[model samples]
Target: MNTLSSYKHDYGPLPSEVSSAIKPIYEELSKEELLERCAGGFTQNNTESLNQLIWKITSKILPAGSKIVEIAAFVAAGTFNEGVLDLLLFMHGMDLMLARNSHEYA
Candidate 1:
Protein backbone atom coordinates (compact mmCIF):
# COMPACT_ATOMS: atom_id res chain seq x y z
CA MET A 1 0.00 0.00 0.00
CA ASN A 2 1.13 3.58 -0.69
CA THR A 3 1.74 6.12 2.03
CA LEU A 4 1.75 9.90 1.91
CA SER A 5 5.22 11.43 1.62
CA SER A 6 6.19 13.90 4.30
CA TYR A 7 8.75 16.66 3.89
CA LYS A 8 10.51 18.71 6.57
CA HIS A 9 9.52 22.34 6.90
CA ASP A 10 13.19 23.24 7.29
CA TYR A 11 14.04 22.01 3.78
CA GLY A 12 15.32 24.56 1.31
CA PRO A 13 12.60 26.58 -0.35
CA LEU A 14 11.56 26.10 -3.98
CA PRO A 15 12.00 28.79 -6.62
CA SER A 16 9.43 31.60 -6.31
CA GLU A 17 7.53 30.65 -9.47
CA VAL A 18 7.35 26.97 -8.56
CA SER A 19 6.37 27.79 -5.00
CA SER A 20 3.61 30.09 -6.13
CA ALA A 21 2.18 27.58 -8.59
CA ILE A 22 2.45 24.41 -6.44
CA LYS A 23 2.03 25.44 -2.81
CA PRO A 24 -1.61 26.47 -3.04
CA ILE A 25 -2.71 23.31 -4.84
CA TYR A 26 -0.69 21.12 -2.48
CA GLU A 27 -2.23 22.82 0.54
CA GLU A 28 -5.75 22.63 -0.88
CA LEU A 29 -5.84 18.84 -1.12
CA SER A 30 -7.90 17.28 1.66
CA LYS A 31 -6.78 14.32 3.77
CA GLU A 32 -9.26 12.13 1.93
CA GLU A 33 -7.82 13.07 -1.43
CA LEU A 34 -4.35 12.09 -0.25
CA LEU A 35 -5.57 8.76 1.06
CA GLU A 36 -7.43 8.10 -2.21
CA ARG A 37 -4.28 8.69 -4.25
CA CYS A 38 -2.38 6.33 -2.01
CA ALA A 39 -5.00 3.64 -2.40
CA GLY A 40 -4.96 4.01 -6.20
CA GLY A 41 -1.17 3.72 -6.19
CA PHE A 42 -1.34 0.53 -4.13
CA THR A 43 -3.91 -0.98 -6.49
CA GLN A 44 -1.73 -0.21 -9.50
CA ASN A 45 1.32 -1.74 -7.84
CA ASN A 46 -0.56 -4.91 -6.92
CA THR A 47 -1.86 -5.27 -10.47
CA GLU A 48 1.64 -4.96 -11.91
CA SER A 49 3.02 -7.52 -9.49
CA LEU A 50 0.26 -9.92 -10.31
CA ASN A 51 0.84 -9.42 -14.03
CA GLN A 52 4.52 -10.27 -13.67
CA LEU A 53 3.81 -13.44 -11.74
CA ILE A 54 1.25 -14.59 -14.26
CA TRP A 55 3.59 -13.83 -17.13
CA LYS A 56 6.45 -15.80 -15.57
CA ILE A 57 4.24 -18.84 -15.14
CA THR A 58 2.84 -18.54 -18.66
CA SER A 59 6.26 -18.28 -20.19
CA LYS A 60 7.43 -21.39 -18.39
CA ILE A 61 4.33 -23.32 -19.41
CA LEU A 62 4.63 -22.43 -23.09
CA PRO A 63 8.33 -22.10 -23.87
CA ALA A 64 7.45 -22.86 -27.50
CA GLY A 65 4.44 -21.96 -29.69
CA SER A 66 2.48 -18.76 -28.94
CA LYS A 67 2.57 -17.24 -25.48
CA ILE A 68 0.67 -14.27 -26.86
CA VAL A 69 -2.62 -16.20 -26.72
CA GLU A 70 -1.89 -17.23 -23.15
CA ILE A 71 -1.24 -13.63 -22.17
CA ALA A 72 -4.42 -12.49 -23.90
CA ALA A 73 -6.35 -15.16 -22.01
CA PHE A 74 -5.02 -13.86 -18.72
CA VAL A 75 -5.87 -10.27 -19.65
CA ALA A 76 -9.39 -11.17 -20.76
CA ALA A 77 -9.87 -13.10 -17.55
CA GLY A 78 -8.87 -10.02 -15.57
CA THR A 79 -11.39 -7.91 -17.49
CA PHE A 80 -14.14 -10.45 -16.87
CA ASN A 81 -13.32 -10.80 -13.18
CA GLU A 82 -12.32 -7.23 -12.29
CA GLY A 83 -14.01 -5.32 -15.12
CA VAL A 84 -10.86 -3.32 -15.92
CA LEU A 85 -10.08 -3.30 -19.65
CA ASP A 86 -6.41 -2.63 -18.92
CA LEU A 87 -4.35 -3.72 -21.95
CA LEU A 88 -6.73 -6.55 -22.89
CA LEU A 89 -7.30 -5.20 -26.41
CA PHE A 90 -3.58 -4.75 -26.97
CA MET A 91 -2.88 -8.30 -25.82
CA HIS A 92 -5.61 -9.63 -28.10
CA GLY A 93 -4.20 -7.76 -31.07
CA MET A 94 -0.73 -9.16 -30.38
CA ASP A 95 -2.17 -12.66 -30.27
CA LEU A 96 -3.81 -12.10 -33.66
CA MET A 97 -0.59 -10.79 -35.16
CA LEU A 98 1.36 -13.73 -33.81
CA ALA A 99 -1.14 -16.15 -35.31
CA ARG A 100 -0.97 -14.42 -38.67
CA ASN A 101 2.83 -14.42 -38.65
CA SER A 102 3.08 -18.09 -37.69
CA HIS A 103 0.75 -19.02 -40.52
CA GLU A 104 2.67 -16.88 -43.00
CA TYR A 105 6.04 -18.25 -41.90
CA ALA A 106 4.89 -21.86 -42.18
Candidate 2:
Protein backbone atom coordinates (compact mmCIF):
# COMPACT_ATOMS: atom_id res chain seq x y z
CA MET A 1 0.00 0.00 0.00
CA ASN A 2 1.19 3.54 -0.70
CA THR A 3 1.04 5.55 2.47
CA LEU A 4 1.00 9.34 2.42
CA SER A 5 4.60 9.59 3.63
CA SER A 6 5.81 7.02 1.18
CA TYR A 7 3.88 8.68 -1.63
CA LYS A 8 5.43 12.00 -0.67
CA HIS A 9 8.92 10.47 -0.74
CA ASP A 10 8.35 8.79 -4.10
CA TYR A 11 6.33 11.44 -5.93
CA GLY A 12 7.30 14.71 -4.16
CA PRO A 13 5.02 16.91 -2.07
CA LEU A 14 1.62 16.04 -0.64
CA PRO A 15 -1.64 16.39 -2.57
CA SER A 16 -2.13 19.94 -1.37
CA GLU A 17 1.13 21.16 -2.86
CA VAL A 18 0.48 19.32 -6.10
CA SER A 19 -2.96 20.84 -6.43
CA SER A 20 -1.68 24.33 -5.68
CA ALA A 21 0.99 24.02 -8.37
CA ILE A 22 -1.46 23.56 -11.23
CA LYS A 23 -3.41 26.33 -12.97
CA PRO A 24 -7.19 26.40 -12.41
CA ILE A 25 -6.63 24.52 -9.17
CA TYR A 26 -8.12 21.35 -7.84
CA GLU A 27 -7.70 21.65 -4.10
CA GLU A 28 -6.59 19.01 -1.59
CA LEU A 29 -9.92 20.21 -0.27
CA SER A 30 -9.92 18.64 3.17
CA LYS A 31 -9.08 21.80 5.08
CA GLU A 32 -12.03 23.35 6.84
CA GLU A 33 -11.47 26.75 5.23
CA LEU A 34 -11.19 25.22 1.78
CA LEU A 35 -14.25 23.06 2.29
CA GLU A 36 -16.25 26.01 3.55
CA ARG A 37 -15.25 28.08 0.52
CA CYS A 38 -16.36 25.28 -1.76
CA ALA A 39 -19.59 24.66 0.17
CA GLY A 40 -21.36 27.03 -2.18
CA GLY A 41 -20.37 24.73 -5.08
CA PHE A 42 -18.91 27.30 -7.44
CA THR A 43 -17.35 26.28 -10.75
CA GLN A 44 -15.89 27.90 -13.88
CA ASN A 45 -18.70 26.96 -16.25
CA ASN A 46 -19.94 30.49 -17.06
CA THR A 47 -16.48 32.01 -17.30
CA GLU A 48 -15.22 29.21 -19.52
CA SER A 49 -18.29 29.42 -21.70
CA LEU A 50 -17.84 33.17 -22.11
CA ASN A 51 -14.20 32.67 -23.03
CA GLN A 52 -15.15 30.08 -25.65
CA LEU A 53 -17.73 32.45 -27.15
CA ILE A 54 -15.28 35.35 -27.24
CA TRP A 55 -12.60 33.24 -28.88
CA LYS A 56 -15.06 32.05 -31.49
CA ILE A 57 -15.88 35.65 -32.35
CA THR A 58 -12.32 37.06 -32.21
CA SER A 59 -10.29 34.02 -33.34
CA LYS A 60 -7.39 33.12 -31.07
CA ILE A 61 -5.29 32.18 -34.10
CA LEU A 62 -5.37 35.79 -35.30
CA PRO A 63 -4.23 38.75 -33.22
CA ALA A 64 -7.09 41.05 -32.24
CA GLY A 65 -6.92 44.65 -31.03
CA SER A 66 -8.21 45.68 -27.60
CA LYS A 67 -11.33 47.31 -29.06
CA ILE A 68 -12.05 44.23 -31.16
CA VAL A 69 -11.57 41.98 -28.15
CA GLU A 70 -13.81 44.21 -26.06
CA ILE A 71 -16.51 44.17 -28.73
CA ALA A 72 -16.18 40.42 -29.05
CA ALA A 73 -16.61 39.99 -25.30
CA PHE A 74 -19.73 42.20 -25.33
CA VAL A 75 -21.27 40.34 -28.22
CA ALA A 76 -20.36 36.97 -26.73
CA ALA A 77 -21.78 37.87 -23.33
CA GLY A 78 -24.97 39.35 -24.80
CA THR A 79 -25.49 36.35 -27.03
CA PHE A 80 -24.73 33.90 -24.26
CA ASN A 81 -27.13 35.53 -21.86
CA GLU A 82 -29.99 36.44 -24.23
CA GLY A 83 -29.45 34.67 -27.55
CA VAL A 84 -28.85 36.18 -31.06
CA LEU A 85 -32.02 38.28 -31.08
CA ASP A 86 -30.50 40.45 -28.34
CA LEU A 87 -28.45 42.14 -31.08
CA LEU A 88 -31.63 43.38 -32.64
CA LEU A 89 -32.64 44.97 -29.36
CA PHE A 90 -29.28 46.69 -29.13
CA MET A 91 -29.64 48.03 -32.66
CA HIS A 92 -33.17 49.22 -31.94
CA GLY A 93 -31.94 51.04 -28.84
CA MET A 94 -29.39 52.81 -31.01
CA ASP A 95 -32.11 53.85 -33.51
CA LEU A 96 -30.54 51.66 -36.18
CA MET A 97 -33.07 49.82 -38.33
CA LEU A 98 -32.33 46.49 -39.99
CA ALA A 99 -33.60 45.45 -43.39
CA ARG A 100 -36.23 42.71 -43.74
CA ASN A 101 -33.53 40.15 -44.64
CA SER A 102 -31.47 41.07 -41.57
CA HIS A 103 -34.55 40.79 -39.35
CA GLU A 104 -35.22 37.35 -40.81
CA TYR A 105 -31.61 36.37 -40.12
CA ALA A 106 -31.98 37.41 -36.49
Q: Give the top-scoring candidate (lDDT).
A: 2
Candidate 2 residue-wise lDDT, 6-77, digit = tens: 654546455766556772454355657877877797755788989999989997787899999998898888
Question: Top model by TM-score, which number?
Answer: 2
lDDT of 1 by residue, 1-106 (tens): 3444563556757877998898778777656777788775564565676666556546555554566657656775565455544444555666744355543433
lDDT of 2 at 47: 88
List per-candidate RMSD values in Å.
11.9, 6.1
| Segments in model 1 whose C-alpha atoms lie over 4 Å from true places | 1-12, 30-106
| Model 2 error, position 20 (Å) | 7.1
Model 2: lDDT of residue 93: 76
